[model samples]
Target: MKIALLSYSTKPRGGVVHTLALAEALAAAGEDVTVWTLGRGGDSGFFRPVDPAVRQEIVPFPDVRGEAVGPRILRSIDTLRAAFDPAGYDVVHAQDCISANAVSRCVRTVHHVDHFTTPELIACHERAIREPFAHVCVSAAVADELRQGWGIRADVIPNGVDSQRFELAAQDVPGLSRWRSRLGRYVLSVGGIEPRKGTLDLLEAFALLRKSEPEMRLVIAGGETLFDYRDYRTRFDARAAELGVEPVVLGPVHHDELPTLVAAASVFAFPSNKEGFGLAAMEALAAGVPVVTRDLPVLREVFGTVARFATEPAGFAAQLRAACADPGSRQAAGRDLAAGYSWDRAAARHVVLYRGLLG
Candidate 1:
């Protein structure tokens, strides 16, 4: 069957990552798969190279300087809608709010639900959830949220991690040495200084953690998003200054270098206020790095006993300290958990769902 998977951007956001990986896996399983995404910021392809077997349809979405996010989002919907013809595919799956809103009919994947204040965005989010014929959630907790909030039932399909890639990175002594030489004894966070990412919370946690581990650095990587977080960034910078802590903000690390970066971390901190499945944390786990995540049900469901769970700054600081000092069997347990999430299994489940929908 011909399958079309749509996402808002060609960046390395969790949802986009899920789309690309799922498409490749489906293609590998002898199914015709295509991934459609908006090539934002002069990008002609994904952040990383995709499998040759899966077709790519990157709709040109040039940047508009000084444009408000609301207007830009609406324009993005209009532009993608104009370019994408849904009639050609047997299964049309929309991966995010923008793509879901633009398409006439789709199987929407509610990776994580968000609350929007703007009227247009609120409406768009509502329509995307309500209009989609079928829905998928990466965690059962997210599916439960969909059911409780909108009375919408969704299929729960967890994300698949590239366990081998990160596992190999852990074993790459030279690669690990390079990253460790660059940033020594660092507590790492992936997902930038956005409000949803709980960046200020991380700042506070890092400052507190520094009290004990004075020489440890706070290293943050990856901040590619369609949303403008300048205001939140301003707040984050101010808080970092107030707390007398400086962090190494390496925005958007290269795809090939990311696994090594993950492997080199002393401890991984993911104090996100919200998340779908905590994919970045999982990648760190796969790399044999100890991970501490925000105490969210979805993350709890995904990580189980493999990850240390925390809520606020103090909690996060405490967990990070424990993770760094003594990871124990959690590291091995984490590797096992990460390896269990296979893209092949996820793709086969998707095929079953798609066929069920077609029938």
Candidate 2:
């Protein structure tokens, strides 16, 4: 089957990572898959490198503007492109909320919701999630939010990672010792510097933890934020300096190197206020690193009994301390849980969904 994916902002973030993994998996399973996106920096920065098998077609358009032409009109233009060229593909999958609204009726459609927290985005998403396209939610919590808040029914398909790549290595790298020495032995947090991700809360928790475990260090990995919030990285660094604790900030590590980063951690710290599905937490679990996340429904569902849940920063710090104290049991439990998921299994499920939609 020939499939086309519509990605409005296909950047190197969680959602884009999920999309590419799924696309690659689908191609490996013998489906011809291609990605249609507004090229680099057109809408949102397109940072991810595309797979060789998965074709990428950048839509021909200038930089997106303010509400002068309006988003609806821009969406209509994207829809026109799909409608005009409906010859090659049997199905079109839209990975973006707004872009899904414009797919042609000739092609079977699928829409995956990575995360939808705002009411305005939800309302806009509702228009795209019509009868022809099957709606897929990254987590049950996300699905419930769509139903309860937006009344949009969707199939729950958790976001998947390439487990093999993230698996624990038999031998550690020669440079790992130096890397760890520089990073220190504290809890690790990896994600963009954003307020919604609870980076500030993580720093606060780390500060609280340092009082007891003075040697503990908190390492953050990711780039600076575009949105004006608390300047999470800055705030975190300042707080660490104020407390006289070691805080390591390693800007965005490569996808291939993520396993090393996770494996080196004493414990993986995720204090996000919300998530569609905690992909980073899953990666940590896949790497046999125990997780400490907020008591959110999506995270609870993903981690199950394999992680430590905390509601506040103090509790988070306590959990981190406990997790660090018992690394062997935590790693063992995480490894066992991660064994349940593989890229091939996730690919097979996507194939089934696509075939069912065609039938």
Candidate 3:
């Protein structure tokens, strides 16, 4: 079967990571899979190397300075729509709002629903949810959201983790030494300083956390996005200064070094207000690291047994303290939990869905 999996950017955002991994897994399962994406920032390929079996279509997406977010979103839709042809593929799956809007017919994986205020964005978000031929969500909670909010039924397919890679990184003495030497005993968070990420909350939590354990540091990594959040970033910087906490902001860590970075952390923080599935937390789990995430239904569904959930900054601070002091049994349990969510399993389920739709 010929399959085309579409996503908005080649950056290492959660959805793009899902897109590439799913494409490779589908190809591994003997399906002809092609990954179509807008190569934002003049990039020509994915953040990391993909298997050669799967075809790639990276449409050039150059940046326009001072372009407003609304106009940029519209242009993204227009550019991708003009370049993408949906004739040959048996299944066309859009992995994000932009890609979903670009295609008229598709199975959209609504990773997470956003409450947009802008007119164009609000319309785009609405159409992306309403117009898809079918829908898939990574968790039952998100699926329930689709049913309740949009009256749409969506299939639930959980994301898969690269468990072996992360697990092995935990054992790499030299690599762990490198990260440990650079950033000693840190609480690591991926997904940059954005409002939804609750980075300010994390900063507050880290500040409170530091009161007790002054030796441990707060480190944030991996922030690649199509949207501009300069205002949020400005707020984050000001707040960090106000809190008097210096967080090591290592933007966009390399794919090769990520596993080791995840493993070397004293704790992994995921204080997001919204999430479909916490893939980064899952990867940290795969690395045998303890996770502390915001208490949300979707997070509870995915990480209930494997992680520590917190309500607010104080809760997060407390949980971080506990996780670092005694990570407890969550380490072993987390790795096992992550190991269960295999990309092969996710791919097989996707294949079944595609076959059912095609038949």
Candidate 4:
């Protein structure tokens, strides 16, 4: 079968990651697959190299200085719609709201539902959910949300991890030594300082944690997004100052270096207010790092006993302390759980769904 998997950007966000991985897995299964995306900021390729068997179509998108978020989103949809041609594909799958809006008739994977107050975003989110010929969700909790909100039924397919890559990083003595030398023992969090990521909550928790573990540092990495979060970022900075804590913010770490970084973390923090599937937390598990995440139904479903869960800043601080005190048992359990999710299995299920749709 010939298929097109569409996403909004070539960045390292969760949905983009899913698109690339699923495309490679489909190609490995002897199906012809192509990934279509807007190359925002002149990005000619993805954050990491893709397999040669999978084709890529990157549409050039220049930056519009001083443009608002709503306008940028509308322009993104228009730019992708103008460049994409759907005539030669057997199935077209959109991985985010922008791609779903760009394409005519396609299948959409609702990774998570967002609550928006802006007029453009509200309309865009609604159309993307209601107009797709079929829907897919990465977790049953998210699928159930769609069913409750729009009366739409969706197939639930869990995300697959590149477990071996991280597993190998855990054993890289030189790499671990290098990071440990530079950062000392630290708590690591990916996904930047955004509101939805609960960055302020994590900052507060880190301050509380320092009372017990004075030498521990907070390291944040990998934050690239289309939306404007300047206001939220300003508030985050102010809060950090008031709490007298400084965090090392590494924006967009190299793809090759990520595994080593994750593996070297004393613990991984995933305090997001909202999530579809906790992919970053799962990667930390693959690296055999103990994980402490927000207590949500979706995360509880995904991590179960493999991770430590907490609700607020105080709770997060307590959980992080406990996990650091003893991580051996959870680390082993997390590795086992991470190894069970495979890209090959996810691809096989997707192929079945596509065939059923065609029939």
Candidate 5:
């Protein structure tokens, strides 16, 4: 079967990560697969190298200064739509709003539902959900939302973690030692400083967390997005200064180093207001790191008893403290949970969906 998986950007966002991993897994299962994406900011390929078996088609998208989020989103849709041709592939699947809008008829993976006030984004989100021939969601909670809001029934296929890679990184004494030496004991969060990520809330929690654990630092890494968050970033900077907490903002850490960084962390903090599958937390779990995430139904559905949960900054701080205080038991459970999700299993399920559709 010929399959084309689409994503909006070449960045390390969750959807893009899913696209690449699923493509490779499908290829490994003896299916022909290709990944299509927009190469924003001169990115010629994905943040990390993908397997050679799966082909990549990166449409060059040059940077446009002063482009607002609305216009940028529209342009992203246009650029990918203009470049992509769905006729050659037997199955075309879009992994994000932009890619779903780009193609006329295809399968869509609704990783999560976003409530957008902006006109363009609202329309794009609506069309992406309503027009797809079929839908897949990373978690059942998201699928339930789709059913409640749009009366759409979607198959639930959970995300897959690269468990061995992270588990190996946890065991890599030299790599872990190097990161520990550089960053000290720290709470780490990926996905950049954005409102949706609850960056300010995390700053507040980190500040409170520091009252007791002064030796531990706060480290944030991996932030690449099409939308501009300058205002949120400005507020974050001001709040960090006000709180007198200096967080190590390592923007876009090298992909090769991510596993080690996750492994070396004292705990992984996922304070996002919204999430589809909590992939980063799962990766941290694979590294045997304790995870503390915002208490949300989706998170509870995905993580179950594998992680600590909180609803606010104070609660987040308390959970972080607890995770740091005694991580051994949670670490074992987290590792087991993370190891249970397999990319091969996810791919096999997808292939079944595709064949069912084709029939």
Candidate 6:
């Protein structure tokens, strides 16, 4: 069977990563897989290379003249892509809203719902893409949101971590020696620096936590998101300084190095107000590190009974403290939960879904 995946931007975002992983998994199971997307900055003018087995094509959509490109440009590219690649694959999987709106049927499309907020966005989404034959939500909560808000039902397919890439050792060993000496027992949060990611809330919780746990540090991984990166960075840096919470913001570490960073942490703190699925928390759990997240439905669904959930900032701070105190309990629980989550299993699920669609 041959499968084609469509998305607007195939950059190294979480959704893109998920698509690439699924494509690789499908290809590994003897399906011919092809990915289609637009060209991005600093990348080769071809399919964003993943597995050698997977084929990719990039439709160039460059912003011409000194003017900014918006919906018109995207629509042009989408029109061209849809017209050119209509009958090549057995199933066409569209990741986000952009790709979903562009392609029409007899392509068995899978639209992944990462988040469902804003009625305007929903209306635009419906107007843009043809209703998919099937939709996949990373968590049950996400599926429920689509059902409740948009009147769309979707299948629940939790994001799976590559356990081999995120295994833990006997102890928390800092792989990077330079930062290892300075960075001691800290709570780790990995995501783009954005308010929706709850970076500000995490900082607030950490400020309160530092009053009791003075020696504790907060290690933040990844760079800025949609907002003004410069302003957000300055404000966050200043807040940390003011609170005297030793904040280490390492901008965008390589995905390969994430496991070591996660394993080195005492606890993984994810105070995200929004999430399609808590991949970082799952990764931390996979690395045998305890996780403390907010009372979000998706987090609850993904972590189940293994993670500590807090209703408020105070509660979150307390949970973090408790998690830090008896790290072994969380580690044991995490190891147990992490056992079932693997990219192999996730890939196999994709293979089944694709085969079923083909049949």
State which candidate, 2 or 6, has the greater lDDT: 6
Question: Could you tell me every candidate's TM-score relative to the true structure?
Answer: 0.99, 0.82, 0.99, 0.99, 0.99, 0.84
How well is each residue in 75-150 modelled by candidate 6, as lDDT tens digits? Answer: 5445545554758677887776666666765232232343435564555466443377777777778778778866
**Which digits, one per residue and each the tens of the lDDT, describe model 2 over residues 171-270?**
3664356557777675878776576778877877888888888887778886533234445557866776786766677777775566777777889999
Worst 10 residues of 3 by lDDT: 327-336
- Poorest lDDT segment (10 consecutive residues) of candidate 4: 323-332
Give the alpha carbon lDDT tens digit for every residue of 29-70 in model 4: 999999999999999999999999999999999998999999
Model 6, global lDDT: 0.70
lDDT per residue for candidate 5 within 103-150, as digits (tens), equals 999999999889888999999999999999899999999999999999
Q: Among these predicted structures, which one has the highest lDDT?
A: 4
TM-score-best of 3 and 6: 3
Instruction: List the pairs of residues colliding in candidate 1.
Output: none
Worst lDDT 10-window in candidate 5 = 327-336
True-vs-predicted CA distance for residue 112, candidate 3, Å: 0.9
Estimate every model's Cα lDDT from 0 to 1.
0.92, 0.69, 0.94, 0.95, 0.94, 0.70
Candidate 3: TM-score?
0.99
Q: lDDT, candidate 5, residue 316?
A: 98
> What number of backbone clashes does candidate 2 have, counting pairs of residues 3 or more apart or in separate chains?
1
Which regions of candidate 6 deviate over 4 angstroms? 45-49, 59-84, 106-123, 128-130, 168-179, 224-238
lDDT of candidate 1 over 1-359, digit per residue (tens): 99999999988888888999999999999999999989998889999999999999999999998998889999999999999999879999999999998899899999899988988889888999999999999999999999999899999988999999999999999999999898999999998889899888989988999999999999999898878899999988988888899899999999999999999999999998889888999999999999999999889889988899899899999998988789665888999999999999999999999999999
Model 1 misses residue 255 by how many Å?
0.5
